[model samples]
Target: MSDTAHEDPELIQLLTPEGELREHPDYPLDLSHEEMRGLYRDLVLVRRIDTEAVALQRVGELGLWASLLGQEAAQVGSGRALRSNDMAFPSYRDHGVAWCRGVDHKALLALYRGVTNGGWDPAEHGFHLYTIVIGTQALHATGYAMGIQRDGAVGEDGSAVITYFGDGATSQGDTNEAFNYAAVNNAPVVFFCQNNQWAISEPLERQSRVPIYRRAAGFGFPGVRLDGNDVFASLAVTRSALQHAREGQGPTLIEAFTYRMGAHTTNDDPTRYRVSAELEEWRLKDPIARLHAFLTREGIADEAFLKGVEAEAEELGESVRRDCRELPEPDPLDIFHEVYAEPHVHIDRQRAEFADYLASFEDAGAEGGR
Candidate 1:
């Protein structure tokens, strides 16, 4: 490892891939047995939802969908670490985090179905709309943190913000700007980058010469790399980072070292660019399976509980598939609804022209009624 990599500070992780609990000096979670099980449950349920959504796409209900397949731990761990008072900004692939924030699974399907821009209100769940344009949410999260600071909503301990982006997004200028703004202004936000090894077909080597966490120090903040496959490690690191931000310590960067176990999306094919050996290696580190092993071996959980959880997962998957299949097509007039708060002549004219175009599709006699 480079001296630079060693010199940069990072949080402690509680568990390794072997499913053994390790100690971290900087970050230790004070979790109860129930709390641990709850975290496990969240990961399991979200994974099922993720699987069902992909199946929905395959069956022709969705326009496009992004899979969170191997990323269950990264999303669920970080999502559970957040406080209800804290806000989150996520990319479209963060359905797991959205689930953690109380977003209805059906609401997420609305985006893939092209029925609505995004159906949920951010204020209601502290989850911003799903951003397809990568890295833009980082800025929005930073700005929201600034608002929290200004509003005196941040207590003496400080309030926190977390934003999600992919490995490919790290190269965007907006991401760098977000880091600068968060660092200089001392905004209380955590920039959580899920480096799933591949940015579509591009590999991590193409995006960075050094580890992603090392980039944090360049912007005058702390950063850490967690064993993203270990739910305990991800949760421990994120919980501590959120605490750091809330305590007015400014922003921290978390580069979750994970892999994309499946295709980037249903539209993608991993076989085109990568080898099967890599996928086979990562499969051995399946986050949920590792945690279940840990729980059973440690006497924290057992086979009956595991079977029950699996049954619940199946039920959740069925619900997701059914709801997604029945989602309504968006109303045609909704296209012009939120574009402007106040009306303008050009917008009004354009809307009128659009309405006329739609009316043209109707029979000549029926068009007048519309």
Candidate 2:
């Protein structure tokens, strides 16, 4: 193990639970009134997207949906911190990050609805498709960072990559290997882990004995923990980390100490593993409430402004519902279209076989009618 003294001993916080502003020595966020309100808007809109998706899943429009219910600030803060040149590799539940990357929120429904393998072109938006495999995106991110390094992309105009994972991924071997590779190669990647306490049903204590951020020390890089519910802390810390990586500094591990207020997915039940009291406690620290409180307290926004945000959120929810229902189901043969970049004889043969199989079913139905 490496020395823990190098990392912040406690969680880095900026905005308190009660909406009071506090100063952090290392991560200071100075934002204008407009910026503050903009952050608030992002939080509300993202939460609306999540809620709509969950409802869609419940109504049989989607096969499944991973809820990012309480981790909005962590996703939005780090997402807003990225520059256009920066690449992001996200886990399955990072709908908020997809929104920040300018991806059509409705398009994301295609994956859960089983209409498409991936909803958007990653290269177009600098955001990779959601990775469902545990901790694999970490390796992909590290490899991409290495490519950036090899391409001489490091300095002011260069790019960095940020990979988002959860506390559950910390226990995976791929994640550990990625950490080693990034550390040794000095790859410009930020490992942003949202330690939302529960990984499915397992608690964080089952994943690691120590705070997840301190794991970076053993990898020969700096690691810091922050109040993932506080957008100010998340944005400031992620911005600083991205800058450090772009300037050729090694990887940094940012463990966002958050809570998963909902079930792990549309399938799991939180009541089975966790307590109601824990949920109530985190609800009091809700990300949107804190930011709204700060906005109200600071006189940055009035009742009208707050009401407008609620109206916008409602509009967004409606839009998502309409768009999700409108999405066309893909043709069964469409799956073979992207299996190869260059045509391969074997895949062509397989596609033909599948087409013949479908035609046979149609032929049988016609003969029976005759």
Candidate 3:
């Protein structure tokens, strides 16, 4: 209904775009000086990771890249709110969440570089692989949450599940089905939707008449609309939502009202569907800039500390660029390596046939050159 998230009355914001700090009664957060500085560091570092990935895609090193440029605060805040056992199912653009879960940045580069399907162990980090088929992760998270309940992990301090999706994905059948299942079964899941104002070329107004958060009421769950650009609000609200789910209160939907400052993916051209004026407007609410402003204004981070973070980002970017090029070339037949936990005759035969087919290519190349 409003031009920006800031203008929405229901949107919870603890940090203003102009860098002033505020308080919300429902979602109170008391971060220490060190923690405040850490959040700023988290925002800066994730943006650097995005910048390097974008550059790699442009130079032909990556197959494609989905940037989380303006949505850093939402991802980092929600990610940090989770407990160690809590699981996260992220869409492709959720690199910031992966970082918070201790995933190596080089691992992300390897995935986009086509060297690996995914570079981290989901079980180890409690963070799933980047889901390319949109909205499917919602169902996966719901199932996992149901399993958590079966395991008797539905009490105080219990583990919960959080799944990320975009505004457009709210229209998908799979996501809606998951919501129904989670609500009916009282599964421990938090459906985190980053309503970044656009789903590729389509605007939010075209997808749903009401805000995305209100859709939760129809699914028999509570919903919240928060300023996604404010890290403090994101962290506090998500913490409460996950706690509600863990206590067997069922599903909760959190709509992070933010903007996508970059193209949907490396192959996309935002300029074709959007205009420069809109981009300029959202730039004022940039997550990293707002947090940095707060940290500096409050004197929580000194010049030396800021420079240290910048140097670390530069070092990380250089490492990503170098290691990305060094990632081993994937073997085409490697796809057949882990088809099953145990061997099966059909798999064996299929592997052999595929190998023979690949050999035929080598023979054809030699003969053709001769």
Candidate 4:
């Protein structure tokens, strides 16, 4: 091996691009057949919904969509690793993870549809609303983890939180601060970074000279890198990280090596910045296809089962489209409803005035009819 190769950072990969499963000494899942199928089901449905969301954006029903097309395994595996009581801080592109947290398909459309910031309550689903500002959610996730520690929620079956961010976010000050805080305080949180090769048009090399996983050492924590396209690897690595945090071992950094096969959002024209050759290269490593091949080849799944899964995926796509289209646009009055815990006189007066203004329009229409 070359000296440079030896100097390269360590990556903890347990599954290969060729669909072969490798064993990891530290991280192993005692997954039942049903649990394995359930994980696959989540991946299938999440992708279907993602496709429908993109279509909705094209049809003008949505203002924009942050596509999760190529990062399904990374999101789903990490999301499923969390316990029911654990919290998640997600960025705008985490619809796949949101699905694993039991968030409804319709609930995610509010932000993209320009109806609300976030329609669902974060506390209800144990997942925070989609944070648009890059790296902000990391700090929030870290702070929440600190709160969990204060509340004595970090021992003997206590929950641990996971926060999702992208490669570009690693350069942000807030993200660095989050790491410092989590590491210093021994906060029970997992920082899951999906290193999907690009931060929009910017390539991964432009972000840092050293591999991102190495940053954890500087923060006084352990970090691991896994093949994000390999669901089994991602699942195992994330489960281990979360388990470590829950056991009071402090924060862990998981860098999932994947590729972004789609534009950053519907508004982006990635073709302008990226070459087709690179996209084609990653296409061969498609996460879902690798898993399907592994299952079929191992005799754990067959053509009939695969066909059934396809049918179910199609049904899920149709249902998501139907429900997304049927979603009621938020009432305009909702703007004033949840801004503050206690009502202020000034806000109450402004709300009343706004209602009066709308009433005046109605009254004018009545007079015109008369």
Candidate 5:
């Protein structure tokens, strides 16, 4: 597919780069001034959290970090659209969604810090633990959606599930299987793919012959491509998709056409494969900047409000840095505690053996000191 998918005439876009608002026939956004301001706040704070995490990794505080530097709007917009009962299966980089789901931002740092496999209970926030294995969450989300259907949870107030993945995941067998399963079962699920141009240095050309959204048609469902940089577009399209699923309309595929402005993770360097010019081009379409422009041009927010948001972002950065450094390291034995809910003979015997081995080292140390 062409990299210019974002420029496709059929793509849904509510706000233009110049801060202009356009109307779409199907997905219409009706937001009050306060709601617009709130979206801007979410964009700013999400960016701050990402930046802070990146800084922590560079300083050796975190083992690694996945920077969601440019895709803040895609995450925050769709995340805020979800109802309390709705479940979200997210990739490792969807910290912006975690924020909207009421997850403590500091908890995110623990995973990169190697303090825990998962930071919080998935049930507590209706958000699953970040899945590191690419495209696996798509299958998990589909299975969960099928469960919803079996439970007869398909109505106006029924629940739905949204699975977040990247463009690279489209090539995985797991994702394709999920597409097939969801289509056959008519599961109440939305497949939200953040097509951020480069999937860790391999461009979109390597992943699909046609647009990612177009693949949904082969699976027997409706697909829509939207300007992922536009928060209004993301929110509007996601809300419509979820509603369709809840009303027994089956699955809808949403391809969010955006770009990743930073390295895929703290470990990889984009400078090696991608050119600086490409980065500069996407910078002009920065999600946060356009939204700020719209808010300013329409007089929906004053300079005072913008400045206040900046101040809040700075405070959030400071808080994350401090709390991340203060997090207590987990004990080695705690790994066994989280392995299973119920006890098994093999696990108990292994734990006992490990305990004895640790005790032997302590005994040796004591005798040597004496």
Candidate 6:
């Protein structure tokens, strides 16, 4: 671990809950007024996206949704820290990072709506499709980073890969294996762990005794923990980490200490496992609220602009609702479409068999009508 990482032993905070700004000497920041407001906009808009998706799930428009509530700053901060060339591998809940990668909200919704296997081309956007499996993206990212290294893409002009997983996923074998692999290979990857305190009812205490980031040290790299609710800290630390990776410094582990602030998914009830008091406490460190407070306190955003953001959020909500409804139901056969990049004889035979099986249903319906 970097010696300076211990400077803020408890937590790395650049923005207080009260909206006051704090700075770390190791991480200097100079954001334009517009840039700061833009960060706030990203936070608000992604939160709105999360809200709309949850509502869609409730209405049965979506099969399921993994909410990114209360972790907007962490996602936005790290996401925006990436250069366009940097690749991101996200877990199912990283809608905010997807938004930063310029993925269309409609496309993201398509997956939840069960309309598309994946909404966007990853290569085009430099963002991989959401990985539903817990910690598999870690291995995927590490492999990609090693590929980038083999291709001589590990310098200032090169690219870095970041993979996100929750605290619960840290216990997974794949995630730990990725950590060890990246360390040994000096892969240009960042293992971003959003320790939202619960892996579906299992608290952080139940997961690990040492801080998640500190585990990077054992693997032979630096790990840093930051106030995940503080957008400034998230951005600054991630940006620096990415730079380190690009410069051929080995992998870094970033533990964003945050809260889930909602159910594990539309299907799970957070109330069943946690108390209201815990929720209320994290609410005080709400990511969007802190950024808003900073903007208002620093006079970077005015009443009109703030109101405009709210109006925009409402507009976004409406658009998501309308467009999601308009999406065409995907063909069941589409699943066989991308099973492979090239068709093999076996896949072709299987597809034909499946098509015949599907057609039999139509034949039965015709016979019934007769």
Give me the candidate number with maximum lDDT: 5
For TM-score, the strongest prediction is 5
Computed on alpha carbons, the lDDT of every model, listed in order, comes to: 0.85, 0.91, 0.91, 0.85, 0.92, 0.91
Off by over 4 Å in 5: none
lDDT of 1 by residue, 236-343 (tens): 889888888877889999988788898899999999999998888788778888887778779988778878888999888888888887888887878888677788
- Rate residue 161 of model 4 by lDDT: 91
Lowest lDDT sum, 10 consecutive residues, model 5, at 1-10
TM-score of each: 0.92, 0.96, 0.96, 0.94, 0.97, 0.96
Which 10-residue span in candidate 4 carries the lowest summed lDDT? 1-10
In candidate 1, residue 132 scores what lDDT? 84
lDDT of 3 by residue, 61-92 (tens): 99999999899999999998989999999999
User: In model 2, how many backbone clashes occur?
Assistant: 0
Candidate 5, 232-256: lDDT as tens digits: 9999999999999999999999999
255, model 3: CA deviation in Å? 0.2
Residue 15 error for model 1, in Å?
A: 2.2
When summed lDDT is taken over every stretch of 10 residues in candidate 2, the lowest stretch is: 1-10
The 10-residue segment with the lowest total lDDT in model 6: 1-10
Q: Decide which is better by TM-score, 4 or 5.
A: 5
The TM-score of predicted model 1 comes to 0.92
> Model 2, 1-370: lDDT tens per residue?
1211123458888988888888888888878899999999999999999999999999999999999999999999999999999999999999989989999986798888999856898888899999999999999999999999999988877899999999999999999999999999999999999999888999877779889999999999999999889899999999999989999998999999888889999999889989887788778889999998899988999999989999999999999999999989899889888778899999999999999999999999999999
Residue pairs that clash (backbone atoms under 3 angstroms), model 4: none
Candidate 4 ranges with C-alpha deviation above 4 Å:
1-9, 367-370
RMSD of 4: 2.6
Root-mean-square deviation (CA) per prediction:
3.2, 3.0, 1.7, 2.6, 1.3, 2.9
RMSD of 5: 1.3
